[model samples]
Target: MVLPLELLQQFKASDFSDQQEYEAWRSRNLKVLEAGLLVHPLVPLDKSDNASQRLRQIIRGASEKPIETGKNSESMQVLRSAVMSLACRSPDRSASDFCHWADGFPLNLHLYQMLLETCFDASEDGSIIDEIDEVLELLKKTWVILGINQMLHNLCFTWVFFHRFVTTAQVDIDLLHAADNHMDEVAKDAKSTKDSVYSKILSSTLSSILGWAEKRLLAYHDTFNASNIEYMQSIVSLGVSAARILVEDISNEYRRRRREETDVARSRVDTYIRSSLRTAFAQVSSAELSD
Candidate 1:
């Protein structure tokens, strides 16, 4: 397939200040993921060979490389930019899709059970929705362990015309802000002035982590075909399940407490940070470095 002139132009002008910047630029041009539709399914690609090669290259080293063009772009750089940016155009808006799927469609029975038992919204309002940003954030860090890297390697091979394209993972931070703000607006205090506001912020933070996981896990399914989509789905179920369990167990400590929701969320997030790192090591199937 021919590289679009617009793509070339954007590539030539791409910026890179650090790892974060490099990943950001790659997400915009290479991934083409915008908006909040990360969970939607994917169509097969026309340029399987090139796209796969680029995807792997980018994931392996987007932070290290600067913007270059043509053959000089480096596979990791191109892959990082393309897969994530393209696939995650409207990630946050797609958060609702998690509930849709979790309600029981493709996910196996074990996963479905795990999802609900773990990721409940608990809003007496019954208006709970998985914040995509939260899920994406969780899934992003976790996938660094298995599913994401595996997808990269798989895509590196010629498109089997089967495996899903798990090139992207994300949750919109902007939406997270909106959710936190909304929590603030709608909250009715039961105690001190800080209680409701803190609750809102606390829940919003929890929402951000799980929301990122929700979408990142779902977005993975887009990468595969009917045959392998199920495989990716299984991974999603496990990821969300783990997140749900961890979040709920921690939430139970002080979810509705008069003034400790924020504390609980922070404390839990700290634990999660460690767990996430452990998940990373689990995904390090390539090799384990000895200290």
Candidate 2:
């Protein structure tokens, strides 16, 4: 909470590689502050509030020309005053000592996602860093500011693992496995909460995972072979788990009908396998005729 504001006070352009780098970094932080404090603040703003208006004006001016930083700068002092005034307002009226700026919905998720990225080592070809335990412990400290609970963390971690696996050319079965394992936790969390915001995020996240998994699973004849057959189990489990959660937790139709006879995951996997095998067979026959 104080870190963002603190950085602004102590910032020096000399610390960065170049003036451009410093300016870019400064711009990003200013935008983040503006977003967290004004646009998507955890405590809603009245447009007429002087603090909100002042912060907006400062951010607009900073966008056109960088604000002078340092404790002595009048612009920095005024910016800080406006930001703190806006951030201190809370629904309970008892949180005067605390700031609620960064805890807004999508903003919180985005910040947490960036923090989670630090768990992976960029130099090691996507391997998780050795200090992950320490990094994760530190990350937990920001959960309060980010409005993240274990459930949202699990879901976000699931997405991060799956995304990392995809971005790294899908060679790391360990990443895929890690993703599938995290989905188990996410699935448990999904069953427990019906919060509208959580449900929306859950549906969107799982749908993305399911869609990616099914893309390969539904046409396995082209996607898999002898060398990479090991990936099949994890992909299948991931896809099935995502499908189960979407149907069992997010679907109103499933809740109303309560079909005891249907096995959604199993049926879906079966359909993929059958469809893929038929395609494979037809391709083989066509190849023989051409030969």
**Evaluated with lDDT, which candidate comes out highest?**
2
lDDT tens readout by residue for model 1, 1-291: 112224544454334447655444444443322111122223223344353445445534544764454435554345445554443333343312222211112122222222322222333222224673474355445443333332222221111111111211212223223333333222222122343433443354435444644454433423446654435434333334334433443355545555433443445345545665565566564356532
Q: Candidates' TM-scores?
A: 0.23, 0.68
Clashes of each: 54, 0
lDDT of 1 at 25: 48
Please give, for residues 178-268, the per-residue lDDT of candidate 2 as tens digits. 9999999998899898899999988988898899989999889899999999999999999999999999889898888857866898799
Q: Distance from true position, residue 28, model 2, in Å? A: 7.5
Q: For model 2, name the residue pairs that clash.
A: none
**Cα lDDT computed for each candidate against the true fold:** 0.36, 0.86
Location of the lowest summed lDDT over 10 successive residues in candidate 2:
93-102
lDDT of 2 at 270: 91
Off by over 4 Å in 2: 1-14, 17-103, 285-291
Residue 238 displacement in candidate 2 (angstroms): 0.4
